[model samples]
Target: MTSAQVAKEHEGGEGNRPEEGYERGLGSRQVQMIAIGGAIGVGLFLGAGANIAKAGPSLILMYALAGVIIFFIMRALGELLLYRPVTGSFAEYSREFLGPFFGYFTGWTYWLMWVVTGMAELTAAAIYINYWFPGIPQWVTALVFLIVLFVANLISVKLFGEIEFWFSMVKVTAILGMIVIGLGVLTLGFSQAGDTAAVSNLWAFDGFFPKGVGSSLMTLQGVMFAYLAVELVGVTAGESDDPEKTLPKAINTLPWRIALFYVGALTVILCVVKWTEFADEGSPFVKAFEVIGIPAAAGIVNFVVLTAALSSCNSGMYSTGRMLRTLAENGEAPRVFRKLSSTKTPALGTGVSVIFMGIGVVLNYTVPEKAFGYVTSVATAAGIWTWLMILVSHVRYRRAVVAGRLPSSAFPAPGGAKLSWVAIVFLLFVTGLIAYDADARVCLYVMGGWYVALVIGWSVLKRRDPQVTARRREPEFEKL
Candidate 1:
């Protein structure tokens, strides 16, 4: 039988077990849409302005280099997922191949990443709402946006899928429109009445590496974080209709998607306007639109950015819910998290995630400006850790495959062991950059605290109950 058929049969009833819960009818299109939907959010639309300012003309190289590194990371993840299509994805792979400590670190770190990102988006949504109704308090706006996402997640997995699909469509449309209009402005040399539109602005502004190569490297601190959620494709393997077929289709398309959406849009934007003009603007997207003569560019771009933030918040909830559910299934979390509603969604986990995200409402009120920076930096920490684990998992996986322990017919990452090492080292370099960055330095401490907490918890649990530890170790031993 086909993988889709197998998945359908596995999900025949309302079983909430990991094997069944993940087998809900997520077709290839839904999976593809979800992957794209979960990705391409506020980081690109709302956060790119900050990056554009940091690297100046060299911002293009920063994104391109980051994209290439992420491509290799995704391929490594795809290869690992093809062999073990589980709900928690990389967390599962880490547990199975690496060990319990790795699994514990990976799962909680990933969960924290989503939660923090969700809060950041929620807070950003409130700020956007303030743009329309400055009278409305930031807390109120955050509460409302959080409630909406909570409800959407509560209803059904498919509802979340549907919301993500439309959310992504809006982002995709904005990106494409920006790129096309940017090209038009470049070709026809159109600009605001006070300025001359010339493509030469791309290189004329203190040369391409105005800030030097170190500046481009510094931008990776944010650029890599922006691409963090791109691997949500693999996380859906368990819920997908055909892991073996649909997953590969989604994985294979990632390269093109990155090229067109990220590299393509950034390249065009840089070419259309001089890097000097991008500084201090809240959004380069708005600048691009205004330069193309779009009326009420601020409001139009505000709407787009609001949607992007909401989309990111929504995706953050979905990712957290799934990760927690997977943890529950693996006995790493409370069993209640594993419970699924009739819709095959992690009902309890979604509720908990929403509550966790609601903490942003309080943060929005207290220290508004610092909210975005704090969340992005912390999310960067989690993202790099996750990527590092995926690379480690791949290395272990190849060893298994080579020893005739795992099947070889699964999707293979290019260059085998070598590329995995390259990706790992590159990710380490990005982490080093994060350490060098003053804004991102706090992330190391935060993530370090998190690991310490997890280790303490694990140590206590180990002393309290040997059975729990054994249960957790069983799957790892068996898989390895």
Candidate 2:
């Protein structure tokens, strides 16, 4: 069958209908919240403290620049999603536009990316739990969270969406509250006598770039990592009740979300507390609250960050399950993963992914101090790879449209293919930054081994299943 035939078979055929495949249970509201929740995670709530300490107030600029690049990347993804809204999303796009090898690599790599990311989020969740239950072991916290989210996912996609919706709402409320209170303190002098909340705090202490421009540039890797799951909105398209409406709205709102959440919130944070006062170990939100004399700031921020971590973990599980099922559908993974539950969820895939995430609980006990750093670095590298694939696929997708091989998408990316190139170059620059850092260089080394293993695994799977290889080599698109 031709590529168009394959897409039709997967998307509209009776065998792949909602009752047999993924249910379109995720409503527009759930999708919108999931998009927002995915963008704001532990990276902003907790990791921003260290980034602020490293680059002073200048970190805000890095986030803005990175947010621009992320916007372009999402636009590229949005175009592709509208062109063909599949559960596989980028992986399927890679198969059609790049090649099957790329499809296989992208799908499996993304699965691994979320697996590692889920581990990191679980670790962060454990640490946040420590704030409330000092005597509970970190591993126990990780285990409990893992079990709870795993069960939640196994139940149904709607349940998962509901959980994410509420998780994201809490995060949104916290940031908005912080921004409102922060502005009050800044303009109305609503802070303690010694706490001077003013916009001048951005540069009063030691200027915005206290650590020099180069130091701020170095934090781009972390800033990019914060935007890792924003493209998850694309993944949701396959199960979204209204992909055409919800996907575009979610992608278009990128700038506004970043402006309000990251740029606006961070600006207020710095205005509330000097960058010098932020600690690498604690949350800037909590610190800002304490600076303004909030009595339960630590506990409140702890709960927010805890929810952030859980939100990420929840999203990671959902994406991994769908991705694994996609890989199985494309013969990149075992056939067993293609099996769906009565509710149309990829239960087997979710179970396997959770089993691996359980190892994160063990890592929390074995290497508690270094676990987050290690997994985050690897996740960042993997995330970069996924973004690059999206851009490349978009470039080819546009070419196909221009060549009259495919229909023009309703939501084409602005600047056409040029913006994709720009985003691709920016992603490469961030990858270079990762390689330049001694602490982060290990991620590249790990990725090197990962790709090597993928090639080897692909070779083995090809030999064992020749028909699968042959099917992959077939035309990915129908010729006009």
Choose the strongest candidate by TM-score. Answer: 2
User: Each candidate's lDDT (Cα)?
Assistant: 0.77, 0.86
Model 2 has an lDDT value of 0.86
Question: What is model 1's C-alpha RMSD?
Answer: 3.0
Model 2 C-alpha RMSD to native: 2.7
TM-score of each: 0.93, 0.95
Expressed as tens digits, the lDDT of each residue in 239-346 for candidate 2 is 888888899998898899999999999999998888988777778998988888889999999999889889988998998999988888878898898899888889
lDDT of 1 at 289: 70
Q: Which stretches of candidate 1 lie over 4 Å from their true place?
A: 1-17, 190-195, 471-480
Model 1, total clashes: 0
Single out the weakest 10-residue window by summed lDDT for candidate 1.
471-480
Over 1-480, each residue of candidate 1 has an lDDT whose tens digit, in order, gives 332333345443322245554535667777887777555777787678888887886777777778788888888988877665667787777877888668867988888998988888888888888888999988888888888888888787677778888888888888888887777777776656225556576688788888888877888888887787888887777777668888778777877788888888888877776677786547888877776678988887788888888887887787888888877776677888878877677878878888888876686568858757887889888988998999998998788778866555367998997888998898888889888888789999998899899989788767876565555333221332
